[model samples]
Target: MPGETAPVGLTLALGRLRALGAKGLRVALPIAGHPLGLSGPPEFNARALDAGEAVIVTGVALGLVPEVFQAGPEGDVHSEVVWRSVPVREAPPADVPSLGEAERELAEALREATEVLSRLNVAGAGPAAQAALEAYRARAGRGREVLAPGYPPRALRVLELAQRVGALIEIAHGAGAGAGEHGAAVSASEIAARAEALRPVERTARRAQVAAYNAYVEELERGGS
Candidate 1:
């Protein structure tokens, strides 16, 4: 069923989306307590928050979150992806910094993160952390587009920097037992210090992502698109 919302394949879900008179699409990346990229009715917000990622149909006030599973006799023969639809309500886009401002702020945040990581000896404290950061950087370099066509170059710049910030957060969070501010070995003051340095950077990264994702939609709203 192309019209069916749940238990729908990727192709059918896309067909259903095309059937809707959507003017645009926006990506939402939300975490608990901070609904970063969502502009929603409570139902849509709750679902996007639960899933951590979703796509909102611009003119339709509808959202889609994907749920993936494996299926087969042993539940491993094939993979399935379903797009679950949630009704959304119109809301203003989140207030995000301008591209230049975002770039400058992120540069400062990067310096701060680097200082903290250096002081704490956390840059490569764990091999996993280094590997993860490298992987993210590699992916960003390869993929190139932060959003679809019609967005400004600055939007892509912000998104890439934001991704690096996310990688920093992961580095700080993925350390081993021997790493400072990790596991039982962490001191209370050290843990607090780490959080203090990283929390704002994390928020900044989310803000940047929101700006990048909303760039095209904002343009449309402003008659630039």
Candidate 2:
């Protein structure tokens, strides 16, 4: 078109491309009225296109229609009159998983983590929490069972740290879809603070148990069951 802008149309076009399963695309717009004329007196009338799905517009002017003889001089398709616009490339296949699925999975993770934290708060849950954590570890080792795929040892350590704190003080689901430039960041400070508070206590308790085990082991070595 004559004076068409590119933003809205480009965004919509990109959406269509995404729907078409394109992971990449390139759009080359004519530079104003010409397909190749420019301030830089270059030869071939156009610059080589760049990579990745980005839109580029060249501003050469076709002024008045050039002679048809000049159009396909050396097997060239079009006669050089002034400007020419190239069609946008189709998008590549969409290989990533659905964003909706990503969101749902994230939500479920938040819920599961909080549930685990909640269970750590009961009166007699210390030993039980330890046992559960051991079980959880065993089950997790068997396969990708909850928490997150390829769960890390640190994350479990975090869980154990949370258990010591009697309900990790911070897990929260922020309002709205957690995606975008203006997306909210959930704070881990509160949970961290709670964990810090319980860390000393937990460490102390853990040390005591370790000491008791060591004593028993020593006795067993000395012929004590």
Candidate 3:
């Protein structure tokens, strides 16, 4: 679904806030066209700011961070303006999937990707590729660790997907490198070429993660409805 524009993440964030009984929360965002000093028409800028604010508000509600803030001009003119919120309150149960199930699924995906890279023997690919593979292994190990309870299911799913994205990046970086039986090093050009060849794998993994996240969001939306 290219160019799809469902604000599922933001919607879930707001839903979480409401479920947790948050009231009158105020969030500040850059006035549209003046983001970091750029300028655009007031109407366009306002819409941009509104969209950005939705994301920040959602993140805060999801307990992604303690809070979100912005320090910029007020109304695209004043020099000093701020928007902030109180710390995130506890999330209420929405009866989504269990954290353990999410962790297992993510671990399985990472394992499959790891096996693919291992069979490719990317360590012989080049120093950079080897380093990337090692990093991926470490990250995958961390991602497979046990999950604790109490977080919202949607938030947990997003976190798992975030970890999967990181692992996929490393996999992409190490895509086309393998050492010979003699343990010879690979050329940089060959490694780059191999990475290009493996682009499809990376792309597929990326799409799968995105689809999973979107599906979770859709489920949340349906439940809310």
Candidate 4:
């Protein structure tokens, strides 16, 4: 059951709550079909403990956890027996940065790369080189837009890295094209020099992206634990 996909409603609800930065959520178990929300087999309520536990485990795996309630006519007997001894909350260390903060750091690093590209002086460079530079600038603009908030932390990191890498490659290609078009105007050494200057900025962006991704995974591990 752990390997199986969670029911659609549970997945959607959990995603929504995480996006909203909610804490201390609770859910009623043995969810029935239609108006009651997600449905399981007829024996769902009979195996409420196992089913409910499975859902919670799955949620934890997805970087979220919700308190589950399975009350009957007497009320809360299940919780009293099972969850009574369990600690309800634990605060993370104050120094631990949130996913949003990590994302911002990565975005800033990528913006630095763009700034380096924009400042490069390619005056008198041939049309081919100018075209390549323009393309790289356009990609940089698009990358900034993609870095905007809303996506899950991991997804956002992946997207941002992809955008930066693409732009970098395009810039490299443009530099090569410029060199070829204006063999006299721009020496091969000039193109190489420009690329070398960009290398550190690109490396910085990559390092920041990796750090952000690691922070996100660590947060998930802590939440699951």
Among the numbered candidates, top TM-score falls to: 1
What is the overall TM-score of model 1 with all chains considered together?
A: 0.77
- Each candidate structure's count of clashing pairs: 0, 20, 2, 0
> What is the C-alpha local distance difference test score of each model?
0.73, 0.32, 0.42, 0.43
- For lDDT, the strongest prediction is 1
CA-RMSD of model 4:
18.2
lDDT score of residue 35 within candidate 1: 82
TM-score of each: 0.77, 0.19, 0.35, 0.35
lDDT score, candidate 4, position 204: 45
lDDT, candidate 3, 1-225, per-residue tens: 012343235566456566655332322223333231112334433443554531122223322212244555776653422222223323421222333454555555566555555555654545656665567678666656323353355545645664564565464454434533111225666556546544544444433333333344344545676
Query: What tens digits encode model 1's per-residue C-alpha lDDT throughout 1-225?
Result: 234533755676666677776777777778887787677777878888877888878777688887777878875589876667888777764446667778888898888777777777676566666776677778877876656777888888888888888777767766433444352215778767777778888888887787787777767867944
TM-score winner, 2 or 3: 3
lDDT of 2 by residue, 47-165 (tens): 32111121222122211111223544567666432222333222321221222333333344445445544544422334433444455467546754223333344333433433323
Task: Give per-residue lDDT, candidate 2, residue 209.
Answer: 23
What is the clash count of model 3?
Answer: 2
User: Candidate 4 residues 5-91, lDDT tens each?
Assistant: 443455565455465454332222322221111123323322443444212112221222233666767753665222211121233
Q: Please report the TM-score between candidate 2 and the true structure.
A: 0.19
Higher-scoring candidate on TM-score, 2 or 4? 4
> lDDT (0-100) at residue 9 of candidate 2?
50
Model 1 clash number: 0
User: Model 4 TM-score?
Assistant: 0.35
Residue 69 C-alpha lDDT in model 4: 63
Error of 2 at 152 (Å): 33
Q: 78, model 3: CA deviation in Å?
A: 21
